[model samples]
Target: MVAGDGQGKNIHDLPDEIILDVFSFFSFNELIDILQNVCVRWKRLAHDPVLWCDKEYIVRGRAQNGRSCCGVTCSECAHCRCEKTDREVLRTAGMMPQLWTLTMMRGTRARILRKICRNCPNLTTLQLHGCQKMNYSLLKYIFEKCPKIEKLIIANNLLADRQYTELVSCLEHLQSLEVFENRRGAGPVLLRFLADTCSKLREINLSCDYHPLEDVEYFVKAKRDTLTSATVRWTMAGKRCVVPVLKEAASSLKKLQLRLFDVALEEEAATFADLGELHNLRELHCNQLCPHRPRLISLAFQPGCLPLLQKLDLPHATDLPDDAVVTISRGCPSLRHLSLTFATSLTDGALAEIHRLKHLQILDLSGCSGLGGSAVAHVAQLPALRTLLLQYIDDLTDLQPSLRHVLDLKQLRCLDILYSGHIRAVPFEEFSVRLVNFRELHVTYEEEDEVFYKNVLLRCRVKCLGSG
Candidate 1:
């Protein structure tokens, strides 16, 4: 039999790119924790550098979510009952001394985490969320052993009263720091200390009510030379504090997210105008959730911030008009990924402007109630689109038939229609192997809808990546 004839060859014969494309759906955490243990072939493929470069060499330990775990073949995660994930991660970390990325969720025991940190001394990127499950000594151990770590993320966790100052100070080479909570030890003290001691820090994301913007300003003033990305959340009443901070880091700032607690301040002094000064700014997200509604107010399309952006998200921008889309098209020529979720005022004119962006690859028009089915045609003509999201377009009844436009997108890989009101499951029946790049479909979660997609995707060899 020939190599192609199933008689002699097996999955090992398939090209690596095909396998990596399927593996891309699973996070790095899942890849090492479960899939690598399935068999020797997969274990070897699991450590492929292509996958590692895309998501880093992450070792994960997460709690059972009741859904299937491991990969597509497994129906359920029976091993989770005994917490096999943690043990497997501990073993893998020790085995793979080259691992540089690690994420430990709530399930991983503190001792196991400490062990992994002790083993992976070459780590450069580390993320630990749900830190309530562990203690401070584990972090101390990680810093002591993994001193070369440059990017660090700690979320949904707390810290000791003034211990953050001591802990973070240890990573003299730290470049990126993201801490989502600061009810206790995380605040100006940590940032201030890093500013004084560490000059390589490039990114900072802190979400807290503890001395919010005032201290961030101080850190930016001190370390503006290297700061490139900044994301901060606070309970304050105004967004004016961020103006000067952005100005200070304008020369180096490339990515920024600021929480505008009070929507009124967004329009008062045109504070967002200051962003126009940041000629180097690339990505801006001002659509922070507010007490009344979640709208990204007019952070105008400053000519300076637009041209260089590769990704832009303006979700729930109720006030965004069609003209703003015009500015986006003319200003952001290199824009690749754009999200206008719930921008209810836009019509087909916005998509027309977007169609002008020849390099656009990902488009999210979810909840754009004003858009007509013509959007389907406009986006289908785009040359490089790989992912398209149209989640809440319930009123656009015409979308059901116009979806045939998707067949034209040869590079399209993922199309999401979660909670898409009028579109039924029947249209997806036509999708098949002819659309080779199409691998993932996101559908609504009703029993009939899920069953229909499962049957169709099974025949098409596509993955149904959960429901909205």
Candidate 2:
């Protein structure tokens, strides 16, 4: 191969394996738009089955001008191209033999969905988003044809009573199911069906508004041993609905996320106590929609709860105080990722405790108004920290002390300090010189400081984004 003449050594003359490897990096749409029309060799490489193995075909109904067909101006716009329908897009995408994921966005028709279910036998993940026309027949067709399907995500769809029952009856083979923002509730019948038939289910996510507490209790009691991950959001029901579900799945559950709409301080405290029983839990996300409630510091600060927990996300936890941070640092030493966004009660004291999390990697302290430069100094102690988001921490004034410490962490990759107005005056040239391994640096500065930082970052050869 090395002996070939210079004329025969062009890119197109490369081996088929090399060409296919290059094609693997491009999205399906990009491949179809650019490489497919280049030449016969490129077209053949683009059509290789390996390129489509885990590809996701996004079928959305929108005019060429990027506006909905139903919009008032779509009919008169020069680039509307309303004639191209969802069926046409699906038909073209269904020609691929190895596609494993199909995401049907708004305006997908029932007949087109049925055709996809019939044609794409290898499809393993189907996500339907805002597909108002999705009905019982289309879902049943999917279950009948794609027997090996493993995950189903249904969001913002409307299902009638009969259609809902048909959908539940077809979930016997699925391993994961996620339902969110449905216009009509699936009701108790759907839960009963899942409990009785979907015994192999390992993950379930329900964020709908119409869930009944009784139905959830029944499902938890029936599927306790088999369920491994569960996420329930926006449920109006109180502790009665949440406690039973947690208690039943305590032994087998690994990941749990709860976002309750109506909850009292005492009720939430009680719920946190139940979580202590889930010793095997690895991820815990608790969000309260209600504001101005008492802090959950005391309940979550227990010493022996969730020994294996690795990720703790409590965004919008307005009541989280510094004591809670100390508790987490002492108890959840295994945590690798932590988020305390909008936790206004946290101060430099919390950051001192958080520095003890030796394995911590990704930390998001955005909107924590109480945090200052001292907190940033504490963050530099973590050896494993990679991505740090300090957006909206307006009190962060000086970056000199923090930058000195951060330069020592060789693993740091991304640093975002957007909207920290007081720190804009620091010489970012120092940062550009010290953070040799940074992949991305996001900052916001006044117009006067932009040119200085841009020139300094250019010299350091790093990607910089935002107002600067």
RMSD of each: 6.5, 5.8
Question: Which 10 residues in a row give candidate 1 its minimum summed lDDT?
Answer: 73-82
Per-residue lDDT of 1-468 in model 2, one digit per residue for the tens?
254567766675679998788788776556666777788888777778788765566555564343322343333432122224765665465455566777665655667767777777777787776645655566677777777678887653432254655565465668888877756544423666676777687788877646567777778778788788888863434434465456787788899887764555446666556666777789988784333344554455467886688998988877687777788888888899998888877778887777778899999988888765577678878889988887876555544456456666667788777776665544455665676667677777766866776677653433444554
User: Global lDDT for candidate 2?
Assistant: 0.68
**For candidate 1, what is the TM-score?**
0.73
- TM-scores of the candidates are 0.73, 0.82
Give the residue spans of candidate 2 off by over 4 A: 1-17, 37-50, 61-91, 114-119, 155-164, 167-173, 184-189, 234-239, 289-295, 398-404, 422-427, 445-451, 458-468
Best by lDDT: 2
151-210, model 1: which lDDT tens digit per residue? Answer: 887753443245655677678888888876624543333556667777788898866545
Instruction: Write down the RMSD of candidate 2 (Cα, Å).
Output: 5.8
* TM-score, prediction 2: 0.82
